[model samples]
Target: MPCHLILSKLADKCPSAVLAVLDSLVEPPQKTVNFKPKQDAVKQEVDHNEDMIRSALRAIASLNRISGGDCNLKFKSLMSEISKSPMLWDKYYSIRNE
Candidate 1:
């Protein structure tokens, strides 16, 4: 009946499908740790993976606050990965709650 319930059921039969759908919803950012688009965009060195982890954490925290459900997310790194998809990123960025 609800989206969360639907997502839970979908997660049981197809994990990737659930992930893909979620990714399309939450969306992801492109900037890495150094606040640059690509390797060449920044002059200084940056730990891309570490930055991704941080950003994902922040994103999840925001989601939890907005959703008002203490989601207690276990794997934040996944959000970083989802944010990479162009379709997902664009859709999420464009969406407005109000």
Candidate 2:
């Protein structure tokens, strides 16, 4: 099974674990000086990070829906992390709407 599916099932059986998993998945923003020579590599890394964050947000949304929104409190820290980037916040709301 996909990792997200496993996480969703785990969330159903143990909601508290969702927060811990999310904490691990949601990383704080990091500032690094990028050299022109590594711009492509940096862009690739940024894209990969965005994908991971989107996946994590989807998992959180699934958990919230499965728990009938009872899991909102557990998402406080995750949401804050998501809100730091406009792109992520938009993606999160779009996922929630879906």
Candidate 3:
């Protein structure tokens, strides 16, 4: 059977389960009001994030060149708290499942 037909049948059989799954699939809206951040703070943060990303990219590229293969991601500890936080974990799982 087609996937939508199967899902409809299952949802008909278990409306609550289907609703729960769908609710989980929906993303929460960003709470940042006036997302255009005020000049200095936003600029600083953007610059910092950009620098970190570039540093990581450089490290990965160098490793790949030296080893002739993809390098392992080595900073799980650095992001563990953020990824495991309640707010972020929910969004992370929702995005991954999608």
Stretches off by above 4 angstroms in model 1 are: 5-75, 96-98
Using lDDT as the measure, the top candidate is 2
Stretches off by above 4 angstroms in model 2 are 13-38, 42-50, 65-75
lDDT of 2 by residue, 40-92 (tens): 57877777656665666666666655443444453565556557868767887
**Which wins on lDDT, candidate 2 or candidate 3?**
2
Tens-digit lDDT track of model 1 for 37-57? 455655333454544534444
Query: Which candidate do you rate higher for TM-score, 2 or 3?
Result: 2
lDDT of 3 by residue, 1-98 (tens): 13334444544566555444443211111112102344667777776644443333333222223321222232232235335567545544453344
What TM-score does prediction 1 earn?
0.27
Q: What TM-score against the true fold does each predicted structure earn?
A: 0.27, 0.50, 0.29
lDDT of each: 0.42, 0.56, 0.37
* Candidate that scores best on TM-score: 2
Native-vs-model 1 lDDT?
0.42
